[model samples]
Target: MAQKQNTLRVGLVGAGIGGLAAAIAIARAGADVTVLEAAQELGEIGAGIQMTPNAARLLRAWGVDKVIGDNLVRFEELNLRRKDGTKVGGGPTIRVEKTLGQPWWLVHRAHLHEGLVDVARKNGCDIHIDSRVASISYQTPGPVQVQTERGATFSFDLLIGSDGVGSIVRRTLFPSVKPSPPTTNCAYRAVVPYSQIRKDPSLVELVSKPTMEVWMAPHAYIITYPISAGKDFNMVLSHHRPNPVIAVEDVDMNDFRNDYRDFDPRIRKIIDMVPTAKRWPLLVTGPLDTWSSPQKNVVLMGDAAHSMVNHMAQGAATAMEDGAFLGRVLRETVSGRLSLAEAITIYEKSRMPKAYFKQQVSFLNGYIWHLPEGQAAINRDKAMEVELKGEQPMRTPNLYVDPTTVLEVYGYDAEADADEAIRSFLEQHESKDESTGITKKEADKILNWFLPEEERFLIPSKF
Candidate 1:
């Protein structure tokens, strides 16, 4: 019989959102899990993150919502408008909650990070700070070893790379892969105290209720919403340029103000009040040919696997989904029901399609939001108006900002999908094996789902 999965020792690189969440998830699956972080302190930046119902449901199930506290602001709508504040189009977020059974939440990044960290500790996950992973070496059919910058080595049954876009783990596994530069856009982010906003009547009206205010223009857009229980307002101004003259990190307040000179005066006032801002260059990576190491004992998760432009705001949520589903797969492996290799295979098949689909849509969203002045942009606005107002017949579809589109994306449950994948895996293998379990052919079929026809010949014949 295979060893019980609870006996598995797992090591995770990076203690960011994805790693911490995965640590809690792996621990819950009855494994001994350790998270290594290069950062000296476990803290999140002061930016904001949106947690749609799909992700919020998982966090609630993991008991993270309670610790997230009342500081979370729940919203019922995402309003899209012109730079002049003219309503263009948007969807009712409450309708999503009604359909999906969980409310959408907006939160400060630090708050969400804190909640995950607290729950991870409660679940008995050993998180080591400042332990930078230098390299990973795996002896197939044996344990995987991780070397840290401090010259210490740790052995584990499996390794997970959650180390953001610039993942050393990913680099060690596939040295040839390189992430693309900024995709013609950068975001300037800032948070303003609600006190300052409330003093201005226009800003007060905007924040009187929980809403996602999106202002779209020809070559730019702005997203603003309340976070930290309305204690502060989060703003992200995204601009598109064919040839960006300055690095995103070097963008200053003057540059930010200049970009939005034509925006609504009221909105500009909010920008002026922001003491400082951080600029982030939007980055993306093409879908990988494979997400696991050659031994299949190590896997990449979150941004390391699919670092997408944040046009759709699915970056963090998708990372959470990856952790949740991985937890489920590990649970099955820990129970001695499946081999580690088989479990990771199922995890990849179950996750890659969904994640890649999200990445594609996220890229498309950037195009839609920053459409240049043309007939296409006008038609897009008209379609959104029709959808938002419930006017006219079913007509053409607005794939970008419609409520149905939102529902289709946020309605997914990663845990549920994982359960289905496991069932399929068992059925496929059990049917193929007379008494000796999966045959080489059956195992290859299960493992080579994403490989090309010519490349599928490489899987070894032995188990």
Candidate 2:
């Protein structure tokens, strides 16, 4: 397969962080990109998010660092304390910069989303608000048809599903797969303005540092950090619900206070000062069998492919990686260096391992963060103390003692990994082929082999 002279049209469903990032990345690579968002207006919807070095590197490379830099707060450490403010675990995170060559930053979700949207538009991506994708149809040897809610249909060379955990594209692909019910875990998020909290002396101490503060408790934990240039505090409290499944969207001050009644007094006041809070019913999707279509022109990225536990704060970071990595693959495809199948296969192979690995780690992190009263929990605190006292290596027999673990996750380079994957795929296939490289037909056959039988449906049209 050689480069096509015509510009590639890419249609992205969902204009969340992943979709916006993908639009920018694809547009930067000279593809005509359009993003369909179901919302009436695109704005920030979440409280806060951490952008690790791995994700920041991609944002900087995409030339939107400045757009998101204004309200960013650089955190130098991650401090873990008990519910009552007793120091227990975590360590200085400045080493993340040393190991990964980039700094850790926190920003309000709205700021980051706005910046990404602006950058994507500046990159010439057509962002269509209120355009909800109703269905997608594959057309072999031609464009894929994307029908939206408004009874309009558009065709593109590729279709990307960057929608969140409840993804229509994913459902369309695996119609038999139902969304998993909510888990026992539930999270409450609130942002306390520094101007309002500064009046309280007890809360002043909490906001004194740029560190990511984690307060561990029995069957619950709270993570708080500064964002909006340290003008506001981003707080997240994750705890087990009494019921197996509970959906709490509206905020209730009394409920929040009751949940963390035993928490630090300062944190209690911080909770009291919050005007409102949003509750998130933590749900986990079963591991997806596949994230791409048989033809590879249509794919799922971000939460649509692999939604994980948020304990590791890698939700947004992993989504960014998805978009960044896919961008790299599409760039090569646009350049005629590889067929769509080969490029997408390489992307899927390289990204699935990292995404799923993080997903598992995130679940483990939640377990460790919210350990109930037991010898195991006591041992964890003891291990953290030992690591902090320099009496033991960071790799103590506890999840909370390791700083290198953070470095490992935050140091991954999506573009480099994708490039390496492409090289390996080329070498392996070229060796098997008698021609200069794998033909388009050969690439499709390899792709089809990896697809499930259900996905082997024929496209009645030339794609």
Candidate 3:
């Protein structure tokens, strides 16, 4: 008789955009999910989050695209400009309305979380808003043990640390490594009133137009993208190092404006018009050696795995991608005859390389904002010129979407993908058996080829 599969239970820490999204996807897959939020209340007071088409495509597949569509400012083009206001070169969006099957939107962070929270609740996820995760236990092959600040304890079959870069789950799993050290790069984020920029026709034109605009300077760059249905502009002004940390409690422009030196007068005017501005230091985090820990059950996702420079404006998008991928992998394991440990190996083996590639890309693209002696600036302009000509030299899509094309992505059919991964594995194994009697070591080498070249380095050669 077929052994009845255990009901997969999941515990997710941090109910930020990524955690909430994970809860919704996992619950929808009929897996039990419980999400814990440290904050007493869920709120997003910061500026805008840029969710590109690759992330949007996955959101659409999960059935929340309508919620995303309701809060979109579909950009028809993306314009790049120099400090003197000369056009560096801009191009039509590959993800404009009707292009990638859905319109990409930039909504306020809090609102997006609210939508996902509702979806999670409706899909049967247990969400506790006021609870804080104090610690985690990962010493066994069972569910991770979570202790909340309020002394509440819970356990589940899978633990996902979707928390921000300073994840407690990460620390518990890998205690020796220093947590993502705070960086010297600080960001002053704000959302200005539309009427303030709307009065100026030229500024209004840029803000009103359906596009993401970047004004690059010697040491800094300002990214302004439309959100709130084109009525509001979400602006993120960032620069290079040694910046002191800013308090998150309130908006203080006095200290924040120090970074905006020599910016355009209009840009200054918009900055002056913002009612609230909060600053935070930017940090980059890489993949940990043990994503699944000694327990072999808990996994970290989103910023907990790879935190990149904000240059790509993909902090949230990457997290959403993590949630979607996790759901797909778990669904396959439940349906395939594989054990949870085997499924998680497949998950880490599949996702780590993709996440690592994105981290590297973010690091590379970050320099485009600051070009010493204009060398990097020249490369930027050249690429833009090529793009404007309706051509691209490297086939690099905006946001560099090479990670989404993995077999895990194309083969993701919920349960079917697991069946297929297994089917493909067995078929090849059988063929080998019929031919020359392949060893277990040979079988693993063939199966692991599906993982990226970087992660393929993880398996020690046993043959």
Candidate 4:
């Protein structure tokens, strides 16, 4: 007779997007999940987030799409231009949805966070906002133990560090790992009301429809898109500096306008209309040798595992992917099909290389986009122009429109990939033993577990 398996208890640090996402995914898979956040209140500080198809599909599966409600903006077109408003590249993103089976979305960071939190709670996640982690014990333990700053202690079968760039859980697990160094790049983020944008005839076109626009220049670029259901225009302005401080501080409006003084007149007007903005110093962490403790019970996910700059606009998307993938693999462990160690091994093996690749690509994208005015920049512009005109199927300098990159980045299916990995592992390990060998019946059960009825998880359109 087989022993009855108890539900897996998962302790997750951080209640941010990634943590909440993990909570929802794991809880839905029958794990008892608890989330601890350092902040007294749950919220996000950024202006807007680009929820690409890869992450959007996971959100849809977890029913967070419905929770987003009126805050979601589905844009199908992106326009890329030079500093003087010369159109360089960009086109319709409708093909992306058609190819990838999910639509790209834009939303305020706070709104998305709220939606994730709501769905996580509905999925039975016990989230404690004021519980700051003081220390963690995983070195010699049957279960990982966490101590909060308030002297409260909790133990769990698994500990996930989904905490942001500064992750205490990660630090505890890997004492030798150093903090991410500050870069010479920084970004200013702000949200302008559509009503304010309407005041200027030149800006009215920007809000007339759901679209994304990027104006590129030497060592700087400005990206804008509609958020809050087209009621607001979110702007992210990236630039270089000789000495950039690592902090989020209020921008000096005068200095901010002067920095982009050479841009188009319309851009200058838009900058002037901005009442306030916050400057965020870009920081990135190099790939670590591993993202798991020696015991494998304690692991890292999201930014805690692979923090990258926002150059690719994939920082949040990749974090969501990490959470989703972890949840999928851990489900097998909960079902007694795989050990916790085996599940963590699969996760580390599959996610580490992909996440590290994205990190390097994102860093390289920053260099590409911030090239000085020279032959390199001109060649980049010419390539984008040719690609936009459909003259050839060759790779474009703009990653957003590059066919290969678009497919690789947006067309990924985390659940499917995890299922395949599980299948391969079972075939290799379980097939060797006659008693433990996977039978047809067992394989069918695993397939069913991976592919639940689509209708059961579909988000309603009128939610």
Candidate 5:
């Protein structure tokens, strides 16, 4: 089987980073694609979204940097601290873009989204607003139909569920399951103007320039970095909780004076500086039993696949890397000698193990974040002691599988690969078919066989 063009059509069910990136990838591959978003306006709020070295390479290819040139900022260092604002560890930050032969940048969430949308449409994807993906059916040779919220029905060569954790596409295809519960942890998210916080002697160190800072406290952590150049700061405060999941929309920023009372005095000062905030209850997703639909044509991606705790900051980055890799896998399978099943097989075989490893690592990090109060103090003291004794500072471990190592994933161009994959997929399907077209029994066999016994759900690169 070789790549074929039978109108390589794709239906994407989300307009966030994953869906948008996939749209750019597939459309670049010369496939006709449609991106659907449930929200009337698909944009994330203000913040510094970091793109590590690995993921940045693909963005360079997608022209993300040039699109957000002035709006994005690059961090110059990574600094760590003890709970009470005591300096515990420090080091020169690796310039992700320079290290990986691409640009690593931070931008307001809205800016990144708008840039991606613009490029996606420029590349020829049909993006629809407020067209929620209600249900997906794939009783046909490929993805058969997708029913929309507006009572619209459409068919495509493939249907991708890039929707978030509550993916309706996933719900309709897989068995019913309850949502993940809060883990007694929560994050206070804020996007504040640089001009305001820049006045605080302690806080000003953060945004008077471009850098990423992680101030660890006895029971919680604070992260702040530049996004959209020096225009704003993306700040988040995480706390140790027997439970931490607080929905952002449900939060009252004014009450935090009490919420963080027992913690470090410096943290209280930081909280006071934050005039507005969103609360997101930290929730942990159990390891997915499997992520593919019975049809195999409809598979989950990004948070819909595996939503991880933000401990690693690889959530969105992971999704971007996944999109690039997915495009690569298709390109490899279809453009060359493998069948469609063969192509997907290559993809799962290559990606599942790594994805599973990262998922488990996220779980482990969550355990670290939830270290018991007294135990947390002990660990902090130990870390602090080591820093003092060694006369050297501790560094942030690459808790993530660096996105830059993905020469095998996003490195390959989606267009060239898709051209090849389409032919290969079609040939394989053609070889297995009869003039009478697919018989019911044969169709069932194909569907069942293509439906992997188990598939790993992957999230974004801090994606």
Candidate 6:
């Protein structure tokens, strides 16, 4: 396929979900997209990921949803319980779908990655595996250049750093920025096959139908949901790290069992069923002061931009939103209506506040979910109980049912937000037409560049 006229040559580092999502969105917007992956092969190593409505909307738009098809499980509800199986709060998620026009989904991370890879390739993205970026050059009057470890060099008009938490691209952009200190929390992840869950009567309720179950207690919480179309049950247990060293390692089964031994009996049963589990020390990077370089040619996305605590489970979703918004804004550059610098600035301006908000909220949620057995915990439970009993619609401790948070997080539309930002940019620049040379007619055209509503949600046939 021929490249679109005046389209950007985008070199994106990282082929993880965020990178691939950006590649797909950019390629779909008629840019030449090349993705560089450090790994020897393409795949995700994690167990499960929650696809909130915000992320799910982008997946459907990119035609990735169909590619993910049966691998996804659309969960009906979220159940929030005390550590000892006492119900606290959480309600059906069906209303989220109704309110947002997108369903909340759960899927194996590998399946989601595969689907994104397939859709990205179908959309004409070039993905190079085993192509670790060794260095990047940001020359003022020339294209940004990237050198791979294997001695191959690639050049592009724009460079996106989606390389994750330890992003080399990010370091090159802001070398003066210091690394964030590791948090005290660590997470243990495991998957129990649905067959195993079904064999035991005590665990059958977990897989009988799809639901997200969260058991919260002082200094710890465990979240479980069905994945791989309900063929497996995925669990994440977050707790205080016994060892101060921050790393991902195998946890001894006995130690893992002992950690949650005092919790619900059914949880202990699930823990006993697991053969092994991996403990990952939770780490956070910037809610950085800036995500783009001084030149505006190099920018960061996803975890590279802001890797926060996983309490809100919006890390990947926000990254996907970044991809969607970048794609939308860059279309102006592709159409010659906005300069590369202008588009990048608009993207940073539009996305950073919300991304920062999410980062803080995720951190706040960590504190809320792991409250100790005290007056604060009691108050939280009472607020959640009131919401659960339909007594009030005010903000509650339960994020799933928190009206303001749910609307702000799940009902977000990246493309729509981008359009609004672009309009704002045009309006602001148009006021200085004598200096900027942006005529009213040109601004109007740019304002109306969005796709028709009828065609907006249509997936590509190839997908």
Model 6, span 114-157: residue lDDT tens: 99999999989999999999999995678998999999999999
CA lDDT of every candidate? 0.82, 0.79, 0.67, 0.83, 0.63, 0.86
Candidate 4 structure quality by residue, lDDT tens digits, 310-378? 878888888888888888888888788888888899999998998888887788777777788999989
Instruction: Give lDDT for model 4.
Output: 0.83
lDDT tens digits, residue span 100-189, model 3: 454456777766766777677778889887888887877855567889989999988888998877888877776665534244555667
Off by over 4 Å in 5: 95-99, 140-143, 240-249, 262-267, 332-336, 369-463
Question: Candidate 5 residues 327-414, lDDT tens each?
Answer: 7655443445444455555444444555555566665555554455586556644654443333433232222222332332223233
- Predicted structure 3, TM vs. truth: 0.83
- Kindly report which residue pairs in candidate 2 clash with one another: 140-462, 140-463, 141-462, 141-463, 142-462, 142-463
For model 3, the local distance difference test gives 0.67
How well does each candidate superpose onto the true structure, as a TM-score? 0.89, 0.89, 0.83, 0.91, 0.79, 0.91
Q: Which tens-of-lDDT digit does each residue in 341-407 have in candidate 2?
A: 8777888888888888888888888888788878987887877786466343647534423556655
* Over 4 Å off, model 1: 1-6, 139-141, 241-248, 387-404, 431-463
Local distance difference test, candidate 5: 0.63
Off by over 4 Å in 2: 1-5, 139-141, 244-248, 390-392, 396-404, 431-463
Worst 10 residues of 1 by lDDT: 392-401
Model 5, residue 91: what's the lDDT?
43
Instruction: Give the range where candidate 5 is weakest over 10 consecutive residues by summed lDDT.
Output: 454-463
